[model samples]
Target chain A: MKTPWNRFDFLLLPLLGGAFILLLWHLSSHSWSGDLPDPAKTWHESKPYVLEPWAKRGELDQGILRFTFLSLILVAKGYAIALILGTPIGFFLGLSPTFNKAFDPIIQILRPVSPLAWLPLGMVLFAKIKGINVTEVAALFTIALCSMWPTVLNTAVGVRAIPTDYLNVARVLKLSRWKTLTKVMIPATLPYMFTGFRLSLGIAWLVIVAAEMLTGRPGVGGFLWQQYNALVYEQIILCILTIGGVGFILDRLMSVIERRFKTI
Target chain B: MSAHLELFNLTKVYPSKKGPQTIVRDFNLQIPKGEFVSIIGHSGCGKSTVLMMVAGLTTVTSGGIILAGRELSGPGPDRGIVFQSPSLLPWMTARENVMLGINQVFFTATEQERAQIAEYYLSVVGLADFMDKRPAELSQGMRQRVGIARAFALKPKMLLLDEPFGMLDSLTRYELQQVLIDLWRRNQITTVMVTHDVDEALYLSDRVVCMTDGPEAGIGEILNVPLPRPRDRKAILELPEYHRLRATLIEFLEVRAHHRPNSSNSPSGAATPPASVPVSA
Candidate 1:
């Protein structure tokens, strides 16, 4: 059982891994066209595009900044909507077998439908509505629709997974239905709930990008598409990097929050 | 005068694929206020079924259970139950577990009162230091102590224990038994426990009821324990009366073991004892 690996081994493995990837990239691209940049050259070419904005401090590249900010806002809003709506639905589905049976088939049918397909319907519905801007609404709507599935499904599964003995103990103690749910059921199902939360968060990010790409909105996805059309490869790469970095940070923050609360 | 707890011809049956299988039938008993009674029987003797019926966790197929002259329809706060498994909420610390019922059931108590009550019970169960620890962090014995403390804090009219010490090691079981004895002596709460251990029955109860197994399990014998108060295990085992009672109980059980009816519609082989002098109850 005692293997050679330890914490230090894991920490060193990633560093060595990056260097190996860079070595392979350098070797493979040595004879290729200079047009297709190697890892180091790409890093060098992208450095100004990535860091110059922070170094000067007066909103470098308004198109990039605006779309990135707008995309994040939309994703957060959609995620909030999903969490609020999906949690109770998940709770009810988890608590009642009858409800779960009635809803399970419909959820399964709807969950697998592509987020891209929702774009045209979103546009059609929001076009006539004067007050709400259609593109933003469509992006948010698509994000919410796709993200809702996992949270609802996971929550219901979590609820159903609670041991019967715990419920019996709650019943014998004469705990009110509300108290039992809040104190016993919720805590028991929290880890599963968090799993659903993380999955739905990723779904929201994915759906938002696709939703923006399809809607042609002024977000990161839209900016990337514009850069592609204009043949601005550097700007396209910059947008991609920003999106990835933001998504990674958001996920890390969510995991930290989950860890803080997971004291069972 | 109100009976602290009364079971009048109570019976329980489970509906199976074939037909109804009875667990306990025509079971009648009364535990007076402040009395401690223990039930002893072999496995599958419906000892737990009787306790569940009294606790109102299971429905009675016939007859009724009365607590303080009021018939019980379902589970209520008046009867606290301690199960064999320490089903503590895993997410909650010991202090929170103890405080759970106290918050809702006794809403009139101030925060200070609740804390004092929880602390007092924790001290009684010797879990003062482990109050902040979760169930997972504590040993099995420590977790059971929290469970016992939580039940004590509820201040129910009667305590129904369904083999509460069955899962504990022998040493832990003995220590908890002493804690239970002290709590019982101090508070004088009516307690009825189902147990498989004969010594546990003899040591803890004022009266021990022996139950026979079958479709209609009922009291086969009742032994009124005349062992003096604060009896220790070593001291009690040395008594001639204790040895005689133990032997008599063993003989009665052996007889029951062989008396099951066979398929041939004839009396099964009897586990009859030798024609020795019978000890009068």
Candidate 2:
């Protein structure tokens, strides 16, 4: 078999792949999708988002980084809730077959439910907000509901997959139930939990965009929606690039956190 | 020596579609305190089952285990168990894995004392320099060394080793067995190890209990090792009694053990002990 990639061409191949995508985008804009600006034109128009990343003028208008920070805050809140609430539930599901039987079907039915569909329910659940906007509270609720499944499912799987030998070690040592959980269960399940967290984070990020679009925050999703409404496709390109870049950074940070835990 | 650990009519039966297949039937042994005991048998002869039952990792289907005048109910820190492959948590370093037990058993001890305890046992297992390395960073032998350290650090009343060096190469196994025997000599904790290695059984055990083939395996014969303490491998090899015992263990394994039923569902094959067993050393 022949390969397009050389054995040692790791970075060069990926860079070339990026160039190929740019060329396609440039070609597509020139022909079939004439309304959208080419990469060069879009880059010229979207330079301000890069030059001054954190700027705020109105409740609905902000620079890219400010919008990203808001999006990050929203995802962080929801992901924290998911990690806190969903992790224990997963531990139970893995440890107790009765609990798994009781909740597995419910989770399976709910896990694949479109995250956007949870938005209206989030709206109903948090209809009355004290200081914050109702839509903002609802959107927060939506992010939590949507992002928690991966963590819950992955944690359960991780728990189930813990080697019996480890459990035996726990037993043979007469580890108190709490110590067993903290030492044996948590450490063994962490890699899986992190996998779940990364996925949950991804979902949270995805949900925030849609939630912000509907809820009207000065976040990336909100900005992208605003650009769409204003027919400013060039700024939409900026939002896309910013969203991708931030998501990459978030994943990298998660890996760093995983490594940190691994040494403990 | 008076018995410190007693298994009276110990049995284990696992249920299958056909029936409840008995793995160990009416198996019995009594070990004095500070004794190193090995259960030697062919694979799947329920030697590990007996060890696990003693460790209380596996629930005893029938009968009871009495340890130090108390009826053993469930697994506790009093029994330190090392499995076939040491299952150290991938996230924790070797020191942390050892410390996991130290923190629990010695909860009242000072933080510094606990750290010292971990360091002390890790050094005993020859992992002083590698204590900071995680299980993933360690070799198979080194990881097993960590397991040994973790178990020994608990200061358990009994130590159970289920083929602790089963996964290691011949050289690694020999070195670890030496390490294990040295540790056992220091504390002389009542220990039960399951192994197929005749040399291992003879080297480390005060008594070697040969088990028959399974589906109802029980004690076939129990051999006492008259070999002196602080055993040297080459020195033991020179002793006439050592080779005789080794040959006997190897003989039981090759001849009598083959009578047990294969997985093909031949109950009749196992039912008739002293029947035709074609294999021999």
List fnat, each candidate: 0.61, 0.82
lDDT of 2 at B197: 85
Superposed model 1: Cα runs more than 4 Å off:
A1-12, A19-37, A54-67, A234-242, B1-3, B214-216, B251-281
TM-score between candidate 1 and the true structure: 0.86
Q: Tens-digit lDDT track for model 1 on B1-281?
A: 46788889988888876567776767888889998898887788788989888877788899998898788887776777788998888888999988987886788989999999999999999998889999999999888889888888889888888898999999999999998889888888999999988788888988888787654577877788888988888999999888887776677676743332221233221322232422121
Please state every model's RMSD to the true fold in angstroms. 5.4, 4.3
Which candidate's lDDT is highest? 2
Best by DockQ: 2
User: At residue A78, what lDDT does model 1 achieve?
Assistant: 92
lDDT of each: 0.80, 0.85
lDDT per residue as tens, model 2, A150-238: 89999999999988878877776678788888878888888888888888888888888888888777799899999999989999988
